[model samples]
Structures are given as structure tokens and as C-alpha cells.
Target: MTTPAPQPIDRSGFGTTGKFNVSLSKRYNFDKIFSTAAWVATLFGLVVLAVLLVDILIDGLGRIDWAFLTSFSSRRAAAAGILAPLVGSIWLLVVTALVSFPLGVGAGIYLEEYAKDNWFTRLIEINIANLAAVPSIIYGLLGLQIFVRWLQPITNGRSVLAGALTLSLLILPIIIITTREALRAVPDSLRQAGFALGATRWQVIREHIFPIALPGILTGTILALSRAIGETAPLIVIGAVSYIAFLPELSPKGLQSSFTALPIQIFDWVSRPQTQFHTNAAAGIIILMVVLLIMNASAIYLRNKFQRNRP
Candidate 1:
């Protein structure tokens, strides 16, 4: 059979010679518009952040010196320092880390590795997620009632320990959620292989799962602690004294000693009508931001190191 002759190509808008003609101006314009919008959105946030940072630095840079770092809060802004609040914040971080890390990680391990998927487990998970979203002030009230009033013998009502406990409660749900996600990321094959090699479940998790998940756990914990560091309302409700002039002793007694934090001190300074105090508040803000940045940098370094070393 002979093949039929090919038909002429349709080129209705062009000359007799077959040539394709197309216009992509509309699509090109749409892409350009979307790209510009995205760029603007990204820069908008960075611009605001830059402006605030510059303003704070300009207001406070001259105030930061050795005296500002060493002296305690005083009526005279020039003589005032962040010694008490800074020490209190450090103590609070230590206590909160000690209280929250083990509990949150253990709970996450049990839920992700041991617990059967039942209604009770589901209910607990749902409640935890909801609690994470609850306002920090609510946790403060809970801590005040339970840790301060109810367990006053130990917490000493409105002490550093009490504040730490409150902050721990506030960050517990976040730690738990982050831990469970990290645990879930571990492959089941690793567990099965360990079991086949005569290792028990506990051994498998202790040796295999924990090391792998540590980076993520650390990152989450640091971020939570950073959030806690900036919290004001919870500490205020739990009675973190705003006018503390002395550092708490670093001993058992210190846990019960009255304390203040950077945020509370900043709030106090900002509330005052004196311009000097406002400048002092800006200095405190700079310190707080530095602390947060350090923590975030640590998190990033740890995450990267672990990711590089992962099998």
C-alpha cells in the first residue's frame, strides 16, 4: 500500500509559508508579578526587624558597660545594672531545663514507641496539643496555685524555683511534641534489626533511637527555653519581684529566694516615666536578644553537626 501525501500544515495567521506564531506576554507578566510579590513579602519582615534593631541599639548602646553589667537595679538609672535579674534568669533556665527535659523526652518515648494506639493515648495527645496553644498566663496561674500556694514548703511561693516550674509547665507540651516527631522519624527497620540481634526494645531505643533523636530534641528544647526566657506575664503572675536588688544565693536557699528576670526588669524600666529608665529598658532588650540569638545559633550548629554525622 502507498502512503497518502501529507496534508499542508495549518498556519492561518501567518503567510503562505508554514510558521508557528505564539504570544507568552500574559504568562510572563503573571510570573513577574508573583516573583515581585514574594520578594516584597520577604523584605517587609526583614525591614521591620532591621528598623527595630537599629532603634534599640541607638537608644541603648552607650549605656552598656561594665557597671551596667555588674551593679544591681537602683533608683538612679546610671548606677542601675542587670545583675539580679540576669542571675535570676540564669537560675530559672537551669531549673527549667532540669525539670522539663527528662520528663518531656520520656513521655514522648513512651507515647511513640511503647503505647498502643488507643482512645486514652489519642485523648492525651489531643490535650497536649491544645495545652501547647494555651496562653502562657494560664500556666502561670496554674503554677501559682499548685507550686506556690499548694507546695509552698518547697517552692517558697514566688521564688525562682516557682518561676522555673511555671516556665517548665509552659514549655513541656512543645518539648513533648517535638520529641515525638523526632522519634517517629526513626525507621522501623532499625528497631526490627535490633530485635533480631537479640537486643531488647529498651536497649534498641537507648542505643539506637536516642542518639539519633538527640539533635532534634536539643533544638526543640533550646527554642522552648528561648521562648520562656522572654516571657513576662507568667513570671509576673507567679510574683517574680520586679524590684529585686540582690542576687539569690547559689544554694538550696537560693531556689526559695525571691527573684526577678530580664523581662520583668525591662517592663519595670519601660513603665517608669524617666527617659533614662527607658534607655535602660532598651539595653535590657539588647541583652535578651543576644541571649536568644546565641541559643538559636547553638541549635543550628547542633542540628547541622548531627545531620552531617547521621548514617
Candidate 2:
């Protein structure tokens, strides 16, 4: 007896007796809608940013000549410039980086490579993570109390050093966290191999792990510094003045001198009733943006270069 031939599959459901089945095309309409929505969301931020940039450029382009950069702040809007605030910002950044970078990187190395994994170490890690999320203003308040009031002789109240210290504290958690992450990204096999070769732990970390992690570490540091540069609340809390007609003296005494930053100056300008001051504020914003762009570009360049040079 011959077996009955198997019937052909009706994948198309086109036969008269075939039952209806779901079609894959049913989801296409939903996918199209979601794709369009995502595109709109992405463009929305870019559109807003473009509009802001165009407005600022239109208002401030003519105000950004050399004279604007060199002249001091003036009651007359036409004569007002960013020289004092600009210099103060530079000094603040220098101090902040000098203090924060070494301390942050050292703390990260200790926590990641040296610390015994225990309750105390875990607690410290948790606190650092929490600190990264703390408000900048709180750091400013801490600076005000510790650096300004408590250590008046050293920091001087409302001074560049005070502001720098404040900003440094503000960015320290970020730096530490990023550094740890960078170190952690290095493969464990490298460390093991270094040990297998009879190298010391410090030698392995310093010679092998750190070199491999340097690019990420530097990128994170630059990004953290960028954030510090833009911070206004912490500086304000640390008593940064809105007006300083003279340049900082660039000495220890200068570090203890009263100062203002670009953000503070812009805030002062925008707060004034005069329309020309508003225009000046726009010009200041343009300058601040340019500085930020340069910092970010440098970070990208350095990160890429180091990555390329890595074995």
C-alpha cells in the first residue's frame, strides 16, 4: 500500500478553505510611527541649540574683537570687556586642576588597586558614588565655611583660591569615579601576566595598567574640568564677585585676591536694566561657548591620539 502524498503547505492562506493567519506587515505601521517619533525627538534638541547659537552670534559677533578681550569692565557698556573675569576664570581653572587631578587620580588608584575589598572600602566607594551626585552648591557652601571662614588666612574669604578649591571638590568625585572606571576597563589578564613575570603589583599597575588606561583617564579629566568651568552656583556660593576691574596678580597673594569669572560677569550683565548690558552678556556667552568648544575639541584630540599610540 502506498502512503498518501503529503499535502502542500498553504503559507499564503490563498486557498478557499484556508484559515486566516496574522501577517507580518501588521507591525509595519507601528514601526514607521515609532521611527518618525524618535527622529523628531532627536532633532528637537539640535533645533533648539541651533536657534540659540544663531541668536547669540547675531547679537555678539561684532562685540568680540581684541579690544573687547583686553579692556576691563566699565559702567559704560560700550567700554566694558571681559579681561578681568577672563583672567580670573583661567586662574581658577589652573588652581582647580592642579589640586584636583593628582588627588583624584591617586584616590582612584588606591581604591581600585590597593584597597582591600572590605566593608570599609565598600563604604568609601559608596560615599564617593553618592558625592558624585551631590549638588554643586553644597560644595560651594562647604568651601565658604572651610576655606573662606575657617581658613581665612590661607584662602581668604571670597578669593580665587577659595573658588578654585570649591570647584576642585565639586569635580573630585567625578574624576575619581571616572578614573576607577578607566582602570577597571583594563583586562585582568594583563595584570596577571605582569605578576606571572615576577613584576611587583605597583610595577604592573604603573607600567602596564595605567598606560593602557591613560587615554580614558585623560578624557574623563578633561570632561570633568569642562564641567567645573561652566559651574556658576559653586563659585557664587564661594563668594565670587561679579565685578573685578583689575587682573589677578598671579602670585600667592593673587590666589588670595577677590575675583570674578566669566559666568559671574555674564550674570551681572544680564541682571542689569540696560539693554546694552544684555548685549554684552550675549557677547560673554559667546566667549564662554568658544572656550568650552576648544576644551572639548582638545579632549577629543588628546584621547584619539593617545588611543592611536597605545600598543
Candidate 3:
């Protein structure tokens, strides 16, 4: 015969014979307090951001127009436009995406799936994590020494390509880490199932795992690209000009052309003593935000579409 069920004993708020015990009540209360605190913190952050955004809109909304977007920088604030830097920023985004996406994702896949855990791998992992936290200016200096000077022949010395490569280096570690995290979030059972079905490792990743992880991968890529787009120090260190009178042609040759980006342009404007330039800087900030928003929207759209395409 089955032994009598253990008596529900009150042992300091554990194993109680009630719908809810003291321990559960305490835990529930703790969770409620934590959630309330989190909600308050989130609301505070949103309020601050909203206030800043509203101020920027008021100061800069009138300044943004077709003429402002299409023209080049000029001494007259009314005539100034973001044409050069805008194009340069786009080019940098494209080039940096090209450079970093494959390398970062591939490295992450290899490290997570293929490389056996060892002292060497752990050291590499430690270095990558440390690198992600390094200051942007440090990357600028490194870029100055490597891409701008040592590889000047290949990078065409202070060109958009050089800036893009530098930005790629800046975000590569972040992307790799994010990719690995996304991959790791997949259940181990998926891999086991694939192997049980006689699939190769690569086949498992390609056919079953990668699709599930793709959305997360895209999110990480978006964050990395956003950081690259707003970067100024590296571009400045690599000699991105403040005034590019003309847009670089959209060709392979253009990759090596001198460039500027939104942050660089805004910095130049804000540095000037003229009040109008400061207003223009605000407008530039708005434009930069728009570009970033558009990029993110497109990526999100694509990610959603990819998900919908799946069975």
C-alpha cells in the first residue's frame, strides 16, 4: 500500500497546506514590488527622452526642408544642407554592413559550434568581451594607426572605405557576441533532433536553427550598425573631412573617396559660434535620427517578412 501522504507541516513558511503559503505570498509581493520599480524606471526614461525629442522638434522642425536635405554645407546657415555627409553616412552604413556581417556571424558560428572549449578559446572569448567595452576613441586611434596609416594604400587613406572598415572593427565584437547569444538561445533539443535525423552540424544550423535565430541576429546587426552610423571620433581621427562639397559617386571608385557623416557634420555645426549653426546642428540631429529610424524599420520589416515566410 502507498505510504500515507506526508503531512503538510508549517516549517518557517515552506510546504504549507494552503492555497498559498507565506513563502509564496512573500515571493509574490517581492515580484510585484520589482515589477513596479521596473515600470517606474522605464517610464522615467521614456519621459526624459520625450522631453528631449520635443525640444529638438520645436527648434529644428522648420529648418528641415528639401533644400536643407539636398544642398551642401555653406557658410550661410540657411543655405547649408546635409547632402554630402548624408550620402557619406549611407555609404559607410552599406560598406560597414558588408564588411562586418559575414565576418562577425561566421566567427560566432565557428566559435559556438565548432571550436572545442579550451584555454585558447576562453582567452579569445575573454578578449572579445573586453574589446566590446573599449572606448570608441581607442578604436579611432587604432583605426588611425592601422587603416589610415599602415593600410593607407589599400584603404585609400581617409576615404569612406577606411571609415567603414574602422566602424566595422568597432562593432564586430558586439555583433559576434550577439550572434552567439542568439544561437545559444535555441534549444539543445533542436540540435539533438537534427543529429538524430542524420543531419550534419552545418545542415542542422542551416535548415533548422539559423532561421529561428535570424530575427535576433538581425536585431543585433541593427544595433551595431546604428552605433557605426553615429560614430564621429573614428571618422575624425581617420580624417573624414568636415566639408565635402560634392557627393561621392555611387561606384566602386567612390568607396575610396573622402567622406563625412551625420555626427561629423553636426559636430562642425555645433562648434561654430553662430546661433544659426546650432539650430542647423539640431536639424542635423533630426536627420540623423530619421536615417537611423528608417534603417531600423527596414530591418524589422525584413525580419518579420522572413518569419512569415517560414512554415
Clashes of 1: 0
Writing each residue's lDDT as its tens digit, candidate 1 over 1-311 gives 99999877765654433343333455678899999999999999999999999999999989999999999999998889998988999999999999999999999999999999999999999999999999999999999999999999988888988999999999999999999999888888999999999999999999998889889998999999999999999999989887877789989899999999999999999999999999999999999898889989999999989878875
Per-residue alpha-carbon lDDT of model 2 for 116-168, expressed as tens digits? 99999999999999999999899989998999999998886888889999999
> Which regions of candidate 1 are displaced past 4 Å?
1-35, 307-311
What are the Cα lDDT values of the candidates? 0.92, 0.91, 0.91
Which portions of model 2 show Cα errors greater than 4 Å? 1-35
Best-fitting candidate, measured by lDDT? 1
Kindly give the stretch of ten consecutive residues in candidate 1 with the minimal lDDT sum: 15-24
Query: Which pairs clash inside model 3?
Result: none
lDDT score, candidate 3: 0.91
